[model samples]
Target: MTAGSRHSVSVAGVVVDDQGRALLIQRRDNGHWEAPGGVLELDEDILTGLRREVEEETGLQVTPTALTGVYKNMPRGIVALVFRCRAEAGSLRESDESSAFRWVTAEEVAKLADEAFAIRVQDALAQHLTAPIRQHDGLRILG
Candidate 1:
């Protein structure tokens, strides 16, 4: 870590349950419904970070299935790496960073995610589903 360095690389995932529902977290500070994710410590592989983040934020054991999409945010920036994952263990519960967690259907996620973070969930799903790109204007993401 350095004085001006961001010091972290975050890996987030769209986690699915048995019924093909997405897991969403209600962040304590932001109050947004988002897919489970967090930062990568130095030296950690992206998948390791993604799994670790999902576990920490949702208390659910997850396995990374595939890379969905990667977004490079700017300014107060971050390289947001996303993945497709599935929960294989533990029950849903809030952790230190979140107030609540739930498995919401794909349709429900599109509606429930509080505006700002909703785009990421939508983008991740689009990539997971390998849908066609609507624009290459670049996603302006904010947490």
Candidate 2:
């Protein structure tokens, strides 16, 4: 690692309902629609971080069912672990970090999010036996 180089780990949850719609959030800071997630705290476990992030953003208690994808923001040095989650409890409410919320299908996800974010939702929907590892530049997939 370079002297000043650092990396952060983040977690995202694709909370899917029985109707096959995934929960998406419009970020308060960026106005970008994406899955509910955030950076992990140093003292928390991955699953805990995932649940906390999802709840904080969407006001839903989520239980991660399976890991869907692992993504890296190549330019920003942020590694994100995306999981397929089930809503356990709580009602949807707008929060400080999330300005809007919606339950969207696959097609809607593509139109709402950039490729980098869309891929995470797609992977969760797919529910493949194995998780995929992908790299992106925070907006688009890397070649």
lDDT of each structure? Answer: 0.70, 0.95
Model 2 spans > 4 angstroms off: 1-3
Give lDDT tens digits, candidate 2, residues 1-143.
88558999999999999999999999999999999999999999999999999999988999999999999999899999999999989999999999998899989999999999999999999888899999999899998
Off by more than 4 A, model 1: 1-8, 114-116, 126-143
Worst 10 residues of 2 by lDDT: 1-10
Tens-place lDDT per residue, model 1, 14-77, is 8866666677889998787888888788888877778788888888888877676665545544
User: Each model's TM-score?
Assistant: 0.77, 0.97
Identify the candidate with maximal lDDT.
2
Write down the worst ten-residue block by lDDT for model 1. Answer: 131-140
Q: After superposition, how far is residue 72 of candidate 2 from its true place, in Å?
A: 0.2
